[model samples]
Every structure is written in structure tokens, then in C-alpha cells.
Target chain A: MLEVRGIQTFYGNIQALKSVSLSIREGEIVTLIGANGAGKSTTLMSICGVTPPRHGEILFRGQPIHRLGAEKIVTLGICQVPEGRHIFPQMSVLENLEMGAYLRQDKAAIKADVDEVFERFPILGKRRQQAGGTLSGGEQQMLAISRALLARPTLLLLDEPSLGLAPLIIKQIFEIIRKINAESNTTVFLVEQNANQALKIAHRGYVMENGAITLEDRADNLLSNEEVKKAYLGI
Target chain B: MDSEYFFELLCGGLVKGSIYALIALGYTMVYGIIQLINFAHGEIYMIGAFVAFIVSGVLTLTGYGGPTVLLLAAVIAIIYAAAYGYTLEKIAYRPLRAAPRLSPLISAIGASIFLTNYVQLAQTPDFLPFPELITDFDFMEPFSRYVSSVDLVILVVTTLTMIALTVLIKYTRVGKAMRATQQDAVMARLVGINVDRVISATFIIGSALAAIAGVLIASRTGQINSAIGFMAGIKAFTAAVLGGIGNIPGAVLGGLVLGIAETLGAGYISSAYEDVFAFGLLVLILVLRPAGLLGKAVKQKV
Candidate 1:
């Protein structure tokens, strides 16, 4: 339930998202695999209204949200767990969770969801009183996801959750992502550098180069494709 | 010199430093949370003194019978100052929170200038007398030639306020939120902090402390005017920066150090250039420790 068409985003005069387009449907895990500076983060940023697209439309469930502010877009059930986790470092894990549900009015549901986050990431529960900055990279990543989940958004934007984690932790994180999508029917728009893990979880995938979607296909077929093998899968 | 003379000097400096620390707390708290200096804070102190001026005058004029009337006056002054600080934040700083860096700062300067001029117009730019209840000009000292009961009262009041602020930032939930917000405003916002509101509350608390300092200083000196805020504000800001601009205890340490230095500089160095001693200390200390004495350095990775 998302649509982005011909969006142009810029930092000063340098265009980051150059006339890009993409879409995602409900209950689907869509992946965008790209190298550094390929504008993957910018695409997510544009959708979440952190960097409002200069020349495009972003529709979530057929409502225009391109003009909305970042927090307003969050209220519309679109949440972006930014690159680098961006967890409030000085806040405790509990306080970070509280902030994630900032826009929600239901205090009871919020508390329940917080419990669920603590249940899923019991490490966070054990360290609830400690500042988020003190958590390890893997734990911080888990806290970040749990925090975004606290928003109770229909769509979750994950950018590089596995960036600095060990292989085992990355595997566990990916498995959890799968579990979340299956259980909650949440639409996940994931951007990643690890094409293999991303492709395995994604229903459909897009390969981006220099701010444009260069290839789009079913994850399995793309994994077996010769160019995909050579360029991304390393098969 | 006798221990009493040295003890008295120490007490006197410590007392004045406590007032500086109280005012410095406001500067440091606002700076800690938003990294923005609320320049109008000094005016909040000025306003608090006026609030005490009005409240205590009325209380004593009505023959409010109690030996504890001075304490009551202090409490009223604190509340009035907090309200003034909160209002200033809501009106001047809150609206410009989203504006660029320089905008809110300018607004703060504007607020400072506006209040200075406003208080001047309202109170008539003349030096006003502090309330006499706490001053007690009738009582002369024993074995003390320079230090008065007025100075002693000021010391007591200022010391107590600083201790209260120390307990606050160290132990309170809201204080934790303030530190978090100060550390990272964007992340704090994402986590659901109404940062603007927290900042306003900080201003309120800080200004309240400053009001205590203002009242104590006014009562001790027995002369105040619109121009008084300029010197007090500058010295207090210097104290904040000296102890590490964002550290609360640092401000107190800085204030005490600065007060002693200034007093000594006036007595032994040059009374006409007492302010130069404060400025010189600030510059010298900051040059050595860019973050000030108690400030920890921050590292950001790109």
C-alpha cells in the first residue's frame, strides 16, 4: 500500500534521488539493494517526509503524503528506522520505546506493545533502565527495530539493520524480520547492502544504481540470473 | 590574618558564588537540553526580584506577623520567577524552535533586550531598594567589621538553592529527559518527548533558581536597577562557561572560583577593573580546556 513516482530529492544543488519510482503492496517484504550512495536511504527518507521529494508523489493507501512532515507521516503508519540505528542514545530503552509510540492515543495498547517488544528482545528488557547508547551494536539494532514496532505502523522502513552486526546476529535479526512480517502482516520496505540475506527474505526485489531502479523481479529468479549472480549474489 | 577573617572571606565568596551558581544553573540547563542559550534568563531573574519586591512589600506592609516572613518571601519570589521563565519560553523560544539556528538565538537576544527595556520603563530606571525585612540594618555585627547579617542571609539562601538544584538534575525523571533531549534533540523527538515542553519546564526551573539569586543579591546590596542584570548575567554566564557550560555542578564551582578571584582582584589588584578579573579567568581557563573545567569532550564520527 505504497507508491512513489518520479521523485527528485536533493541536498543543496546535488540531486540524490533522480527521478526515481517504486511501489509496494500490503503484507509484502520489498527489498532495495544498492551500493553506497545509490540513494536508497534518500528514497526511504523521501517517503517518511524527512527529506520531502522535490518533484514527486508518495501515496500510502491512496492518500498523498508527500507534503507532510516527518512526525505527521509517522502518524499515518509509516515509520523509518533510519540508517545507523539513530536510537536516542542518552534515553533508556524504556524511554526510547515510549517515544516510538508518541503519536498513538491508546496508552493500554502502547504498554502492551512495549511488553511485546521486551518479550521479543528480552535483552532490552534486562537493560531497560540502561541508556540505549550503552547497548552493543546488535542489541542497539534490536532496540531500534523494537522501537519502530512501538509506533504500531502498518509500514516499517528498515535501513541497514544488519550493518555492523556479526553474522549470527544478522541471521537472527533477519529471522525476526520474517517472523514480524508473518505475524503482524506489516509491510516492510527494506534497504540493504547484503543482497543475499535481503533477497532471501524479500518477496520482490529492486536493484538500484545512481538513484534509479535498474532491475525489478521476483527474488528467486533474480538470485539465479547471471548478471545478478555476477553483480550481487556472488553465486 | 585570623581564621575568622579567612573563614568570613571564604563564607562571603561562597555565598555570592551560590547566587552565581543559581543563575548559572539556568544558563547551563537551557544550554544542556537545547544547546541554546536563553539570554532572556537574566531578565527572568530580574522579574523574580520584582515579584519578591511586590510580594514581600505587601506582606510586611499588612503587618504579616511571623519571624518566617523572609522564607515566605523567598518562596513567592521563586514561584513568580518560574512563571515568568515559562512564559518567556512559550512566547519567544517555542514559536521559533523549528527555525534555523541563528533565528531562535536572535529571538532570545530580542527577548532579553525587550525585558530590560520593559522593566526599565515599568520600574523607572532608578536604583530601587530591596525589602528591609531580611536586611535588618538595626543589628550590627560582633568581631566582624565588613560582613553584615545581610550578607550572611544572602549566603544561606544562595547555598540552599544550589543544593536543591544539584539534587534535582541528579535524581529526577524530568531531569533525565532533559539530559537526553540535550544529548540528541532529533532522537529525543523520535522517542516521543515533547521537547519544547521539557525545554520550557527547564527554563521555568532554572529561572526560579535565578530568581532566588536575584532576590538574595538585591537584599544584600540594597540597590538594583535595570543595568544590574547586565553585570550579573555576564558574570553568571561566565561562571557557566567556566565550569563547563553544560555541567550543573561545574557552574557552582566556576561561580565560587570566579567570585573569589573577582573579590581578591578588586581588593588586591584593581577594584575599578573587578570585571576584568572575571573575563580574564574565563578566557584563560577556556583557552586551556575548550569545554571548560568540568565539561567532557564530545566526539562525533562521520
Candidate 2:
């Protein structure tokens, strides 16, 4: 479980996150839906300590992690598959996966986890030796997800997994995301612009606008809410 | 020219090229990780030579003179240079990690100036004679017509160091972390790699190699001065750029090519215009390929 409280983050003179707060219970898929520049990615980044909140506290499993470095945050079992699928361009797929388990010393468990990733994403297994950058956008996204999974993170933060993929690829990605949550029992905090699809899979959802969380509810209620349907669902 | 004359010149060129290659590695590796030129790298090499100078002086006072003493001096210089490199990163480069690109570059230049003046004030500004450590070896008499024992030692040491470095970067875990960092620092951090530690290790390894090169160069020339770092640093930087600034093997190739071209130019044409020939080749390579000989053109994805 993770708790974010009154976090304000700034980029120079402009504020990207304005005292936004949210919480995710264990093993639940919590999606934050927002339009462009709605601070969804900033929220994830603040938790990961890439851009630490200027004023706020983030607690993971009841322990304060807001002040830790990004590397230390990863070791504490919070992994972020960042926006734009930042895979190591020149490294092979296998090496990229190996990097995911960088902090773990248990070699056997790491190997088994990598095998599980390959089994879950067969296409990735086929191109394990190929350079990550040479893969298609969908494959790159898969690689990004698989890489994060290899970290054996208790809570996985996915930023825009469906940003540039085709509809079919997006469907497949979401299915895997669902399967990951079901089988591995991994808590996921997903940030997305695709509200309809995200809310459909998420147990709970938060709607963000202008650096603030404007709405929070059960997924089905938000899916049927007239204002949500009119503004975000395009109904 | 006769074949024998060509062979001798080739040997001489390789010895000089090895030194440049050693120093170029420092520039290329630092640039690869941080995108900073690290102009102070040359002064690190100069400090290596100075350390060797002091070590040799102390050893002589203790009446220890032999190949063993020389080898010990080189090792001590490398260790001291690694420390200098670690300190330099902590002092000059670490604070500017998030500053604009120009800030670290200016800091590097300032560090270079500080190092040069530091050496000039601490030691004498005049050229000091390096001890002749390899002259006693007559085992090279057969090939002495083409190369001296010192040249052979330089060539052998450089080849072994290159092999070791290549292995270190290619197959090791830290090397993998380094490559990962080079490609994407943020992702590297997400994977739990300490990017700062990797960067510091790069500086330490690079500075150690540059120190060895300083010892080799001083041995070859039998003289060293505080200001020697400026031109040597510039030339090695040129080599790094010539071989594709961020590519590792490219640095080695660039150093060798620059060395051979300058040596041959000096031999066959006007000695005063040797640098012009090397720079001309660089311009030609840039005009034709843009990426250095071994560097691949990377396509940026959206």
C-alpha cells in the first residue's frame, strides 16, 4: 500500500502538482485518469523520487520513502516504467531485463523471474538477443513492462503504457496488466489518458485536472457518472 | 623511403599512439557518461607523471634503482591518480549534475586551470628529467635497430591495458550498469543502479589509465613540465572527437590514426605542419561521415 499526502511539486516557477493526495490499497489496480499536463506523471515521479515533492510526504507500507533517492526507492520495491518507454537503446533485451533485477542478490530467483516474464510475453522471448531499441513501439512497451516486472516490485507504477501503441497492442498490454495483478498480486498505480479502458480494469479511479484530484470513486460508478461520461468518456 | 626506415617510423608512431590512446579513453568515457569534456583529464595525467617523479626521487634517495623500482613507481602513480580522479569528480563535477550543460563544462575548464597552476606552484615550472628506467635492458639489442626496449615496454603495457579495459567494460556487471547509465540515466536509476557511483568509478578508472600514459610519455621524452598537459589534452580531445566522442573503441582508433598521420606527416613533409595534417584528416572524416570511423549514427526515437 502507498499513501501520498499534500504533495506539491514544481518545475522552476511553475507548479506541476498542487498539494495532491491519493492512496492505493494492497493488490488493487488504481488508475489516475487525466488530460494533458494534469500531473499524473508528476505524481508517479514524485513517489519514485525523480522529482521529489517540494512539500509532502509519501509513505510506502507505512514507511516514509519521499526523502529517499530514486535508486533507493527502487530497492524499497517501488518501480516505475517511465513515460516514453525509456529502454536501454543499445543493450539487448536480455540485458535490459537483467538491469531490472539490479539490486537483487538472489541469482536463482532473478533467473526464474526473467523466465516468467518471457513466458508471459512470448514475443519478447523470441527477440531476447535483439537490441531493445530495434523493437516496435508495442514490443518496446512490453519490454518496458517486462523489465519492470523483473524487478519483482511489490508496487508497480506504469506511466502511459498505451501512449503510442495500436489499439490491438493496447488491448494485449492491458490484458497482461490485468493478468499481472491477478496472478502476481502486484499493486499497480497506473496513470493514463485513456479513461474508459483504464476505469474498466481499475478497482478504484481518480480523475485529475489542473494538478488536483477532482474526483474519486469506484470504477463502475465513475464509468457511468454523467459528468465523467460527458467530459472524459466522450459519450 | 626504405622498408627499414618505414618499419622504424611505424614503431615510433605506435609508441606515441599508445600514449594518446590511453589519454583519449579518459576523455571519451567521461564524455559518454556525463556529456562533459573533462578538460582537466590532461592535468590528471600530468599529476601522474609528477607523482612518478616524486616516487622515483624518494626511491633513489633510498638507493633503490632497477626495473622493479620503476614498476613500483608506475603502480603508485596509478593509485594516486585514481584518488585525484575521485576527488576531482566529487569536487568539480558532482555539484553540477543537474545544472545546465555549460556549467559542468566551465567547471571542467576551471579545474584544468587550477590543476596546471597547482602543479606549477607545488613543483618547479621548468621541465624535470624523467629517470631512464629501461636503458639497462640490452635484451632488445636484436630489434634495437627498429625499436628500443622502452618502446617495446610501452607497446606491451598499452596492449595489455587495452585488453583489460575492454574486458572490464564488455563482460562485467558494473560495465553493464555503465552502459545502461550511458543510454538512460533515469531508467538506470529505476533499475536500482547507483548512477553517481558508476560515474565516479568511470573517473577513477579513466584517470588511472591516463596516469600510466603520462609515465610512458615522460619515459619516452625524458622530460616533463607543468604546462605539458594543455597541448596533450587538446590533442587527445581531438582524438576522442575524431573517433566518435562517445564510442570507446573509436577513441583508440582515433588516437592511433592521429599518431600515425602526424608522425608520417612530420617525416615526409614539413615537420612544423604536422598538426595541420592531423586536423585536416579530422575535417575530412567529419565532412564525409560526421560520425567518427567506428561510431555508429544513432537515430533518436520519439
* Candidate that would win on lDDT: 2
Q: Per-prediction DockQ scores?
A: 0.28, 0.72
Error of 2 at B160 (Å): 1.4
On TM-score, the candidate that comes out on top is 2
lDDT of each: 0.82, 0.90
Where model 1 places Cα greater than 4 Å from the true spot, the runs are A4-15, A18-21, A53-69, A72-77, A92-130, A209-215, A224-235, B54-111, B135-177, B260-274, B297-302
Top candidate (DockQ): 2
TM-scores of chain A across the candidates, in order, are 0.98, 0.98
Q: Write the per-residue lDDT of candidate 2 for residues B1-302, one digit (tens) a residue.
A: 88887787777777877788899999999999999999999999999999998898789789988687788889999999999999999999999988999999999999999999999998999999988876646778899877888889899999999999999987888888889999998889888889999999999999999999998888888999999888889888888889999899999999998888888888778789988987898898899878888887555456
Candidate 1: global Cα-lDDT? Answer: 0.82
Clashing pairs in 2: none
Clashes (backbone N, CA, C under 3 Å), per candidate, total: 2, 0
Per-residue lDDT tens digits for candidate 1, residues A1-235, read: 9999899999878999888888999999999998899999999888877678999898989999999766577777888788898877656889878767766779899999988888878889999998777888889889888888988879998998899889999999999899889999999989999999999999999999998889999988878878877887777
User: Which residue runs does candidate 2 get wrong by more than 4 Å?
Assistant: B136-139, B297-302
